[model samples]
Target: MENKVVKVIIGILVVSVVFGTLFFWFTPVKDGKKQLDQIKMNNNYLILLIQVINRVLKLAILTTMKDLKIKLNQLKFQIVLN
Candidate 1:
């Protein structure tokens, strides 16, 4: 039962990530740039924000992958134990 819940959660997370990446990547570039520019006048701050955003994106992807791996491992264990 727990394994099934994990699978469902992982499935939802994967779908969310796919849709999120697509949404963010294909979003109008001009608006993004404009907002980034408005947030900070200094180049350094803009660079920092960009870096943070990139890191966050990477971390999110990594986290989702890790969750999936754990769920798969649990299922494998259950299969072996059965």
Candidate 2:
């Protein structure tokens, strides 16, 4: 039950991050040197944001995997004892 909740939360987070990244990546920039320059600056910030989001995603996946591994090990121990 708890695991299902965690999975749902992670799924939502992943979908949101993917959609947000795609939205930023495909957003149109107005035509002009000044506008282009401004977009380039904003792109840098967006890139940083993307990197942070990717890191968060990686951390969440790793944590979830670790938790599953621990739970599996605990279950194995219980079975052995029983």
Candidate 3:
């Protein structure tokens, strides 16, 4: 049950990361400064939400990868002991 939950969460994060990457790539930028100014002026909540989601997804991926590495190492140790 716990494993299933983890898998689902990871899947959601992966999807969010992909969508965020595509959105960032497709978003128009004008002179860099104008982009920032436009975001500020337009009160772009969607951009802010995307940024937050991307950041959270990145952190979650890093954490999940680290956990998997640790589990793999533990499995190797157990095999060695056996």
Best by TM-score: 2
Tens-place lDDT digits, model 3, residues 1-82: 4456656766786686678657755678878897777566445645666676677667667777888998999999999999
Q: For every model in order, what is the number of clashing pairs?
A: 0, 0, 0
Model 3: weakest 10-residue lDDT segment is 38-47
Candidate 1 regions exceeding 4 Å error are 1-42
For model 1, the run of ten residues with the poorest summed lDDT: 37-46
Give the better candidate number (1 or 3) by TM-score. 3
TM-score of each: 0.43, 0.59, 0.49
lDDT of each prediction vs. the true structure?
0.63, 0.73, 0.70
Best by lDDT: 2
TM-score of 1: 0.43
Ranking by TM-score, best first?
A: 2, 3, 1
List model 2 lDDT by residue over 9-66, tens digit each. Answer: 6677667667766766567767788667766766786676677667666776777788
